[model samples]
Target: MTKTAIVTGGGRGIGQAIVERLLQDGMNVVTCGRGAEPADLPEGAVWVQADVVTKDGIDAIMKAAGRVDVLVNNAGVQVEKSVADSTDADYDLVMDVNCRGVFNMCRAVLPQMSETGGSTVNIGSISGMVSDPSMALYNASKAFVHGLTRSIAVDHGPKVRCNAIRPGWIMTAMAEDGFALANDPKAAMADALARHPVGRFGEPGDIAKIVSWLASDEAPYVTGECITVDGGMTAASPLNPGLF
Candidate 1:
């Protein structure tokens, strides 16, 4: 029988790539987001309009997709502000979508997944492992994701496997916009590219391929791991290009 997979925030970016990749892998994919399903979503995938931050939304997704064999928690938000400039509202919004949402989805799906073995792939970020300026809350939220992923692996192991993917500087719409907003878009982009030994930013497909592997039978022994898919951005220091 074909496995069933659910991908949150599948309307665009890495989530959409993951949905498409899973469909290519022959799994029945169910995608959810706060808005209507995008026209570009893969033809074979099912679209559920829901928000990950709310229990009602998560329930709606679970109700639409019964008995999930794989769950990809790709829904998240980012706020660019230092702690002094950040507001309580900013903290709440980021945490609600990034941390609480993951918790809610995992909680709702684990019981059903425990019945039969399954996997969960969370889309964390390199920001969780290292600090970045003007993104304090976003960093903290993803750190929570990494910690939660490990905890879930420990708690639900031998039945349900859990892991996280830490991507760096993916060329998504949000990332492009962030680049465009920089004082010198071209210079900023070039500097960012120089940090990665691969000489380019990551593509969504890079993350999708890893997610596919982690959820497959081939990765049965893999759990509680935070795999980095950053094109070597975090592997070395940006200041010491000669060291690499």
Candidate 2:
């Protein structure tokens, strides 16, 4: 039987890459976004005009995905503001999409998943494990994601496996936008690149490859693990060269 997988916010960037990779892996991929269907949506994949922030939106995605063998909670937002500088709107937007979206998706899909066993691959961030200056809300929300991943694995167990991938600095549209906002985009890019031991930033495909494996039966025993795929960035010390 062809397994169905639903990925949120898959119109472009990391989500698009994951959708493409999963399609290559031979799964019937169904993806959703808040706006209209994307013109460049991958071949052999379905896209629903939906969002993960609302119950109706989630229901729409569920209806589109018929049977959910895999769910990738990739719809997220970031607010680059210090805790003291953050506004209520910032908190709500970040929490609604990043944390609540994942929560709702997991809750909605897990029951159907329990019927025949399933898996969830959440796209988290290395910021969740550590601190990122001016990204207090994003960091906190991702932490919630990591914690929820563990809880889901523990509670759902062998029937529904759940895991999170905390990516470091994938050069996606969002990342590019962040860099573009920097005073010196080139210098910012260089600084970020220097932090990675790999001497390069990550690509969407890098994260997508892991998502493909984690969502497959090959990783049956890999539940509740929040794997970091950051080109060894987290393994290095804060005192390593550049900061000084």
lDDT measured at residue 9 in model 2 versus the true structure, 0 to 100:
88
* Per-residue lDDT over 51-90 for candidate 1, one digit per residue giving the tens place of the 0 to 100 score: 8888789889998889799999999998878899999899
Which segments of model 1 are wrong by more than 4 Å? 240-244
Give residue 235's lDDT in candidate 2 (0 to 100): 92
For each candidate in the order shown, give its overall lDDT on alpha carbons: 0.91, 0.91
Q: For candidate 2, list the clashing residue pairs, or say none.
A: none
Across 102-203, the per-residue lDDT of candidate 2 in tens digits comes to 999999998888878999999999999887777899999999999999999999988999999999889887787667767898998887788788888999
Q: How accurate is candidate 1 locally (lDDT)?
A: 0.91
lDDT, candidate 1, at 85: 93
Tell me the RMSD of model 2 versus the true structure. Answer: 1.6
What does candidate 2 score on TM?
0.95
